[model samples]
Target: MSTPSYALRDSMTMLRRNLKHARRYPSMTISIVAMPILMMLLFVYVLGGALGSGIGLPNGADDRSGYINYLAPGIILMAATSGAVATAVSVCTDMTEGIINRFRTMPISRGSVLTGHVVGSVVQTMVSLTLVIAVALAIGFRPHATPLDWIAAIGLLALLTFALTWLAAAMGLVARTVESASNAPMPLTFLPFLGSAFVPPESMPAGIRWFAEYQPFTPINETVRGLLTGTPIGNSGLAALAWCVGLALAGYGWARIAFRRHAKR
Candidate 1:
């Protein structure tokens, strides 16, 4: 076969492998749906009433449902974050199973194997995000922004997931054992809690406040929130995109180097 045809075949083959991996344990898909629902319910009905005043706005500026406005974006970020949890474990599983070593012998692009996994994860994560949004709407979450901003926010969420998934890929590559891979995502998962996702950064401690205000997740959370609430957020949207793209490049670069070197060995 010609070189181009071989590469195309390899990417498609890897994509299918990723899809198969996603189905290997059906409970993974179930947990993805269930966890976000639990978080949305817990935040909306339970903590929301107690913390409603902290959000400082009704659902749609004048619409009494403001809590949903505040809670919805937070849920989206958290939902996106939840999707990265299993990445490390899955990556480690590939290494453990000797499949990656098998791939090393093939003439395919080494990067495509990792890219395919990320592609599959992104698709699965978006599906989870869609379900979470539906539950939020059924519970009274509404976006005040025009359809454009709504689309932009979802686009941003996908970008956020896209980049973060690469970081997860890097962790999977560098981690020494399957167990460490399981623990790798914990730090990334904890990040949203330090941001405006759950509460306004101004409400946090000065030390924590400084961190939250400047962190990448804050802009991501704000951009999405501003979109949902029709609030004015200016350059921060660009700032968030920059962060996502930057991380994606850095993570993918390192992971590609590692995979290439590992394959050569």
Candidate 2:
């Protein structure tokens, strides 16, 4: 068989292994999925009225529906980040186990192990995002995007998921234990809150507003919001694409190096 064919087969084998783990130990994935949904409900119902009123909605302050429209994009991004954490934990588990050492002794493609975790995590993230979106719709989150807009939104999400999954894989590779791996990706999940996820960055204090606007999550959030609501995306879409590509490349390199170092240790 060709080198590429061998790599593909090995990668698929690892992918199936990861999927089986996800199927058997679904509690972790379910917990990750539940966090974003719970947050959406809390923000939309508990705090939506006060926050919606302040965002200059035409429907006035009582419009939780309008708030949902504004909040859904950010929440979706949050869900993606949250789901990526699972990849970190899964990778960490594999790394600490005897199976990883066994694989290193095999003739299969070395990269396939990480690829499998990344691909499986991206798939899980998409599923979690879908569930979150369904809940958003049920809560009256109306988006005015066209078909192209929807495509763009999904594309951006896929890019974000790919980038984050790679980063999580790197984090997992570096961690000595699953506990550290699980905690390492916690910041990714919390990053959206520091950005414009739950509220407009403009409403924040000056220092926070600057950080919020400058952060990677903010551009991605803005791009999603623009795609979904027909708002002007400006350079945010470009910025988001750049961040995703850059992070994916960086993370891939880092994960490869870390895995090699870990194997040698």
Candidate 3:
């Protein structure tokens, strides 16, 4: 087999290993899926009424149903980010536990180790997304999207997941311990809250409003909200695409460098 074939095979093997580990210890995946769902329930049931009134929903539909349509996209974005911690922790565990040194002695592809982590994380994130969306629907979040809109929304989410998982993998590579790795991505999990996730950026004060408007997750959330809820995407689609691509490249480069630096020790 050629080099690329070997890399692909090794990556697949690593992905299987990661998935098996996730299955054996289901706590991480369950937490990743649970946080978003619980947040959705909290917002929809607890604060949906008051927050709904302020979001400027059409036809004065500022109730639980109306609020859910606006809130579901952001919660879904959170779900994507929630998987990052798992990726980081898993990678760091392998690093600290000396499995990486064992892999170094084998003939497997060098990049496959990281590739497996990334691919497995993306797979796990997508599953979490599915569950979140299901719960959103169950909770009266109605979207006016067409088939194409659904496709585009899901694609954008997958791209965001891919980008974040790579960044998390890099964080894991650089962290000295599993606990630190888990904490490293905490800001990412909460970043959507600073954006237009829960409320419009227009409602925020001066400084935070500006940040809520320009932040990466803001545009991404807007694009997803527009696609799913028919909220007029404007230029958000382009911005979201740009951010995803840029982040993916940056994370990939960072992870490779960190891996090489660690391999030297």
Candidate 4:
């Protein structure tokens, strides 16, 4: 039998276990899954008009797509970020309750545990994101880009979500409790609001504008929006990729190290 084959086998096995857990806690799963849906409705229908008008987007939009397009990426980010919190809490609980300890004694590969959960969280976040997009359709939001644009937009957001899941895994392993674990993603979650997530960062106060300008989320948000709208990335896509790759590597390194240390201990 090939050795690398065993790794794939172990990953699948671990994934099955995680899916079972998700099935058992429908409420936890739904809460994790539905946040994007709820927020999309709340922000797009209820708040989009006033919010869009305030943005000074042109007096007559070619269509009523202003805020929903702006809000779509933010909702996607919010959806992905919210699901990551569940990842932390789930891992923290396993660690605290010694479920992870029990798993360690089993025959599974060590990375399988965290890696499995990361995959599940990414899949879950994507589901939430799909719901948000569906709601966007109902609200009459249309992408200016072609089919390729939709593909790229989804692909970029999915990559970003995976990167975030790895970082969230680090929090899950090291945090002492559920609350602490969930807190790790909070700062990143708040990052978008400061950037062009809701309103354009240029409209902010001078001090706030300075902070939003260089913050990593600005480029990422701009990159996602550009994909949806067919707007040019204008030199920022490279910066966005650098941020995503950097954070992903850092988070994965920290999380991997933490997992190994915990197993040894």
Query: Which candidate number has the best TM-score?
Result: 3
Q: Candidate 2 at 232: error in angstroms?
A: 1.3
Instruction: Please give, for residues 70-105, the per-residue lDDT of candidate 4 as tens digits.
Output: 777777667666777878887888889998888877
lDDT of 1: 0.80
Best by lDDT: 3
Residues 68-130 of candidate 1: C-alpha lDDT, one tens digit per residue: 678788888888877776666777688777999888787777767887878878888898999
Worst 10 residues of 1 by lDDT: 55-64
Please report, as a residue range, the 10-residue window in candidate 2 with the lowest summed lDDT.
55-64
lDDT of 2 by residue, 1-265 (tens): 9999999999999999998999999998898899999999999999998889876743333467788888898999999899767998899998888779999899999899999999988988898889988999888888889999989999899989999999999999988889899899899899999998888888899999999999999999999999998778899989999999998998899999999998788
- What's the CA RMSD for each of the models? 2.1, 1.3, 0.8, 2.0
Quote each prediction's TM-score.
Answer: 0.92, 0.97, 0.98, 0.92
Each prediction's number of clashing residue pairs: 3, 1, 0, 0
Give candidate 3's TM-score: 0.98
* Per-candidate local distance difference test: 0.80, 0.90, 0.94, 0.79
Residue 86 of model 4 has an lDDT of 77
Question: Which RMSD does model 1 reach against the true structure?
Answer: 2.1
